[model samples]
Target: MSQAKVDNYKKSKANRQKIMKREKIMHRLEMVCIALVCVVFVGWIGYSVYAKIDRAQGTAQETVEFDASAVQNYVSGLTQD
Candidate 1:
């Protein structure tokens, strides 16, 4: 082969290799981004569930200390509005 043709072939091969490296790097970055998103999604779900459970556990029922009939009479008067 001529010197010019040999040089052209080498240049083409080098360009192909460069493109492959760039693509590989992009693929790795894409995987990392996907992993980060998945982690955030899971953490949000976990926090939501934890907050729901915490709220349910924190609220406790209490016994009423006043007379119900007296309260009912006051409520009836307020309902006149």
Candidate 2:
């Protein structure tokens, strides 16, 4: 082959190698991003469930402290037709 053709072939081969490296780096970056997103999503779900449980316990405690007479009065009001 002519020298010019050989040089062209070498340049093309080098470009292909560079492109492959870039693609590999991009694939790794994508994987890291996906993992980060998954971790954050799971953390949010856990926090939401924890907050709901905490709020429910607090509300239960508050509601459990009503006076007996007040409960009787309220029950009587509800029973009236």
Candidate 3:
């Protein structure tokens, strides 16, 4: 082959290598981004479930308790008029 043709072939090969390297880097970045998004999604779901459970626990704690003196005082005040 002529010198000019050989030079052109080497240049093209180098360009192909650079393009392949860039593609690999971009693919890794894409995977990392996907993984990050999945992690955030899982964390949000976990937080939502925990929040619901916490609210239910709070509701369960608010049980009614008997208070006799308060009721008697209220009744006496109403009767005074």
Candidate 4:
């Protein structure tokens, strides 16, 4: 049992650098993926809010009243001529 443990320890020691390098690469990749997901989520939320506000403003503009009396008078004058 002791001999097996020693053999395992030596093998691990020999491959330690490779294992550590792989772990470092994996950690960086994980952080990048997390940051990408957060950016996408925030962008989606911002767009939705912008779209909602734009829609509200559009409706408000559509409901506004404008004076057409000048246009009506112009047309009436043209017809009389």
Candidate 5:
């Protein structure tokens, strides 16, 4: 091999442990970040579904009665002036 290639290989070998340790730490950090994102996504979907169910169950269905004679009396009173 060339002299320069041999020297480069020796230098990389000397720091191989340090490089491997750094790579391991980076891989673990990446996995933790991915897990955190998945948890937040699942939580958001759960909250949305819970809110929709709550809204549906909390509303009361009622019938409103309209008074036409009351409205006609009010209009007539306004027109009296």
Candidate 6:
């Protein structure tokens, strides 16, 4: 082959190799980003489930209105009994 043609072929080969290398690096970065996003999503879901369970545990706590007289009467009844 001619010198110019050989030189061109070698240059093209180098360019192709560079492109492939860059593509591989980009692909690896994409995979890492995807994995990180999945991990964060799972963590958020777990937190949400835990929060719901915690809130549910408090559902049975009854709140009594403040009744000073009733409280005093109960205290007196307890003392007499």
lDDT winner between candidates 1 and 6: 6
In model 1, the clashing pairs are none
Task: Give one digit per residue, the lDDT tens place, for model 4 in 23-74.
Answer: 9999999999999999999999999999999999988784658999999999
User: Which sections of candidate 1 miss by over 4 Å?
Assistant: 1-12, 61-81
TM-score of model number 6: 0.57
TM-score-better candidate, 2 vs 6:
2
lDDT of 6 at 7: 100
Cα error, candidate 3, residue 16 (Å): 1.5
| TM-scores of the candidates in the order shown | 0.59, 0.59, 0.60, 0.73, 0.71, 0.57
Top candidate, metric lDDT:
4
Best by TM-score: 4
Q: What tens digits encode model 5's per-residue C-alpha lDDT throughout 31-81? A: 999999999999999999999998887796567998799899999999998
Cα lDDT of candidate 6 equals 0.95
- Every model's Cα RMSD, please? 6.6, 7.3, 6.3, 4.9, 7.2, 6.4
Off by over 4 Å in 2: 1-11, 62-81
Query: Candidate 6 residues 1-81, lDDT tens each?
Result: 999999999998979978899999999999999999999999999999999998998897788888699889999999999
lDDT of 1 by residue, 1-81 (tens): 999999999998979988899999999999999999999999999999999998997786567787799889999999997
Task: Point out the higher-scoring one by lDDT: 3 or 5.
Answer: 5
- The pairs that clash in candidate 4 are none
Residues 1-81, model 3: lDDT tens digits: 999999999998979988899999999999999999999999999999999999999888967879799889999999998
lDDT of 2 by residue, 1-81 (tens): 999999999998979988899999999999999999999999999999999999999877744455699889889999994
Model 5 spans > 4 angstroms off: 61-81
The CA lDDT at 38 in model 1 is: 100
Tell me how many residue pairs clash in candidate 1.
0
lDDT of each: 0.93, 0.93, 0.95, 0.97, 0.96, 0.95
Better of 1 and 5 by lDDT: 5
